[model samples]
Target: MRQTRRAIALFLLVCSILVPLPVGARQAAANPFAELGLPELAVTITDTAIEGAPAERTAGRYVLAVTNDSTAGAPPVVSAGVGFLQPPEGMTAADLIAFFATMATGPDGGASPVASPGAAAEMEGPPPWYYEVPLAGGIYALPGETAYTVLDLAAGEWVLWAEDPTAPRPPVAITVTGEAPANQPVPEADVTITMTEMAFALDQPLAAGPQIIALTNEGQQPHFLVLATVPDGTTVDDVLQLSMTFMDPSATPPPNLSFEQMQDIANTADLSAGITNWFSVDLESGSYLLVCFVPDQETGIPHAMLGMIDVVTVP
Candidate 1:
């Protein structure tokens, strides 16, 4: 009887540990929110210029732009895009690298990847362009961007980067915030800034980082997003800070903004409906106008005249 009780107690004790689970495992299983808070992150896409881009890019250069920002949270991002094409026939991106690692020889005396010239020689395979679609951690396209995939991204501050083994060896580093962002996507964050029938329709304001400004089709018309900002060479303090506590709608673009400002408005025109696009920028907190240039170019009437402008705040 004593042995039986002892055995039973031992079995019950083991079962208790197994049934309740370890503190960490239980925490992981009970409610995911309690551990990671929420899987959602503040990831937004933009076409803004890369914060750290090498002036000249050629072979062995990297081009990167912010595809997504998780705000200031971590496990840094170390990733590459999937659209990298392999070298054909006998050569490859590796060959390109090998070609450069050695001394450049004259026609009389060349290097390892050299032997003769053929139809294949002129063809550099990947064409030195590693195309990539925007990327977001938690927020992703349901069908996925067919042209791109997730490459090895180490844990640290990282942004999307592309490498070319050709000439113009420039290095581009997209901004990757030094923090971790929500690992989930927010449907509401996918905003559509449409311009049609001379009216603007945006549910909320844009922050100072990255975002996706989608343009929908009312007709077969083209639309764009434009906002006002300080003139070029202006300091951050000179920026006109503005925000809509109640989501206002009367901001306007500055007169004669720089070429970059103009491009910022046009780059958001990624042509995949229902598929969100991404861009990143380090913008100053301020008030600005958002409008689209979807008007008939021949008619000389601005797209905003048809109602694509709205007010937004960055705080």
Candidate 2:
């Protein structure tokens, strides 16, 4: 299984660099939120707890502007999101915690958490409704980097937390009011990217500057978008090889080419299948990799391996 998984990862990595997702029916030009403006929420990420975060927000489409205020050096990356679970009938917090404690240390006393990517049932009860912004390249920020993502929340109670467990902040209790407020105007999308089963579609080239990426996922599984700037002189091929080394450590490393990660300008939390979310990002003229890292359920391979990658040039 491991060998097959590694090969699948490598193949998908190569295909992501070469192929583009198919285009689907284009969305209407009129921006729905342009007239009905949605709320803009501010979230501050501190080394300790997420400060200035609210316990409740109106359910609907909203923008989250995350600012990082960790001590100067590269702070540990933190993922921000709302996790909602429909606990089993009559289950209390203590019951759920005890169930999860078992998950923390399963029947055989192994340390593996019961739930993992693509394995939702391993969770104690019904999987939690997760609306999360995946950390860019798995890191929240560099020394002083800040970014934002848009999320669509349904009316419910959600538990909010940074990705790190050791962080000082206690889990935040958020109640997403079931009532969606009056629609407000949202800026027109500068670029729209559509996602499906391991593929993406873009109608036109992206232009440099602050742009909104309207992400529409049509697949049955969740997906997220990461726009990482490719440095000068580095080809997508080089990037793929570097990625392969990490996927399969036994594989030989690429000579002379150091695997330095590029900066990500924009990203989004995992969008449940058949959902659409839009986020704003600032882009300079350059080559970028639009990639998704969601692992496939059956194969345990990432969507990127299944060809969910593309080279985007912003002129």
Q: Which candidate is the best by TM-score?
A: 2
Q: What are the per-model numbers of colliding residue pairs?
A: 38, 15
lDDT of 1 by residue, 1-315 (tens): 222222222221211111111111111012112222332121223222223332222221111122322121122111111112223335443453344333223334532232121212132211122112222211111011111111111122222212211111212332222233334332223356554555657656566764444344343333323344433443322222121100122444234432233212222321211223322223567655554433233442334444445545667
Q: Which ten residues in a row have the lowest lDDT in candidate 2?
A: 130-139
Candidate 2's displacement at residue 120, Å, is 19
> Which lDDT value does model 2 have at 299?
61
Q: Who wins the lDDT comparison?
A: 2
| Local distance difference test scores for all models | 0.29, 0.52
Model 1: how far is 96 from its true place, Å?
32
TM value for model 2: 0.67
